[model samples]
Target: MSHRRPLPRGLRLTVTDEGPGFPPEFLPRAVDRFARAEASRTSEGAGLGLAFVQAVALAHGGTAHAENTEHGGAVTLDLPC
Candidate 1:
């Protein structure tokens, strides 16, 4: 699922997945380069996905957030409108 909300200062875009979500320890380093949870170490991902998202958001003077919701994992990008 995706949600787009317009705040007074910017736009909030959130994307969510119904998978098992990120590991507790991995959440803190989810945006770190080459960081991956054991559950994902064997996956095809290089673990740079969230890092790239964070980079782009920071470069654009915005912010990036990732967390596990009741449903699953979610990544939100708050960018200037």
Candidate 2:
């Protein structure tokens, strides 16, 4: 599911998925370059997805966040209009 809210100067968008979610310890580093969750080490990619997202957000003067939910995970991006 997803939710979006208007901000004073931008918007707050959140997306949630039904999965195992992210590891508590890995949440903080999820946006780091080359960082990957232990469970997905052998999956694919160089783990730059979140890093790239964060970079884009920063470029737009916004921010990105990731966290584990009770059923899965959530990623939020706050961006300016």
Candidate 3:
């Protein structure tokens, strides 16, 4: 995992990890609750991580995204400081 540093004042910070990225089509819907592109009753989660992130960002007047990392994959969050 890695993080951007020394954000300007009024900016919130976030970190990202390298892993299997989700599909591009799913990007638009990633912030929705229970909105898993790979949703499965047999899986562990109830599809809430991205949604939670989105909620936090929104609450802080910002946004979130999931994307393919140059090296792998990552999730980013931007929020008001």
Judged by whole-model lDDT over C-alpha atoms, candidate 3 comes out at 0.74
Best by TM-score: 1
Candidate 3 residues lying further than 4 Å off, grouped into runs, are 7-9, 12-14
Cα TM-score per model:
0.90, 0.87, 0.75
lDDT of 2: 0.91
Ranking by TM-score: 1, 2, 3
Q: List the residue pairs that clash in candidate 2.
A: none
Per-residue lDDT tens digits for candidate 1, residues 1-81, read 999999898999999999999888888888887777775356598878889999999999999978999999999999997
lDDT of 3 at 66: 75
| Cα error of candidate 1 at position 24, Å | 1.1
Residue-by-residue lDDT tens digits, candidate 3, 1-81: 757655575554555556667777887887789888675547788789889988888888888877776666567887656
The full ranking of all candidates by lDDT, starting with the best, is: 2, 1, 3
Candidate 1 C-alpha error for residue 19, in Å: 1.0
Candidate 1 vs candidate 2, TM-score winner: 1
Model 2 Cα lDDT, one tens digit per residue, 1-81: 999999999999988999999888999999899888895466778889889989999999999989987879998999999
